[model samples]
Target: MTLNRSIGILALICLPAAGIWFWQNPTVRQAPQLSFKTIKGERIDLADLKGKLVLVTFWATDCPGCIEEIPHLVELHRQYSNAGLTIIAVAMYYDPPNRVMAMAKAKQLPYAVALDPSGSLAQGFGNVQLTPTTFLIDRTGRIVLQNTGAFELQDIRQRLNQL
Candidate 1:
């Protein structure tokens, strides 16, 4: 092989290896520092939950998809909360606090229901603009998964198991 051709081949191999190393590095994708104010006047700091797997879900009361996922989320919480999974359902800034509270009550949500009235929570989570944006963060505070809309519950369960 020509010198340039050999160098090109080496570059192709090394670049992908470097990319994979960077992507897989746990320190590269840490979740942002954020604190949530739950509906019942409770403060939850993400940093405090470092040793626990956390599922932070951005939702709106008026969102059909968000509403649809509640039952599955509730079940997930039921099955996993005792296994060190903390689920936080965040109501978007545009969602009225009263409506969020009413839905939380009506649905009998078992997990923490937070209010994002100023949209800061969404902003901290990569400026999330859509309802039902969910993030699965590992015990070490690395964000393992980010889903924009509806997600597969089984897949989430598998991930939770692995984490």
Candidate 2:
């Protein structure tokens, strides 16, 4: 009777923990729905890039880490762009569109960029608290990789090679 009771208690305890684990895991969550305006004032749907690897990077113009990461991202885009990779830089901070555009132009970024004025997309993607947070989505729209800090060029290349 004691063994049965202990097993029952264990089952009760483990069930909720497993439920929480599954809830918080990105693999279990639905692919975030993203729709925002590009720097050119055109609307873009995240789903539109199906069948290609998508690199969605959340950044702010004033963030030091973000500033440092842009050049690496640009280089990554340049290197892998012909290999079916699409890099999208999403400016999440509340900055003027012209300011963001000017910065992009100054940096000579070759990838596409969009402004998240409402910040809804960031919130939907799990509140993305840090600047330079990057998400690597596979061809099927699954978030295969998520990095919360700056990434090295070789690291990105290695990850892309797996996809």
Among the numbered candidates, top TM-score falls to 1
Q: Write the per-residue lDDT of candidate 2 for residues 75-160, one digit (tens) a residue.
A: 88988899999888999858677888999999988988898888887897888778889888888888877778887778779889
Where does candidate 1 clash, by residue pair? none
What is the overall TM-score of model 2 with all chains considered together? 0.79
Report lDDT (CA) for all predictions: 0.91, 0.83
Model 2 lDDT, residue 64, Cα: 91
Whole-structure CA lDDT of model 2: 0.83
Candidate 2 regions exceeding 4 Å error are 1-30
Best by lDDT: 1
Worst 10 residues of 2 by lDDT: 22-31
Report RMSD (Å) for each prediction in the order shown. Answer: 3.7, 5.2
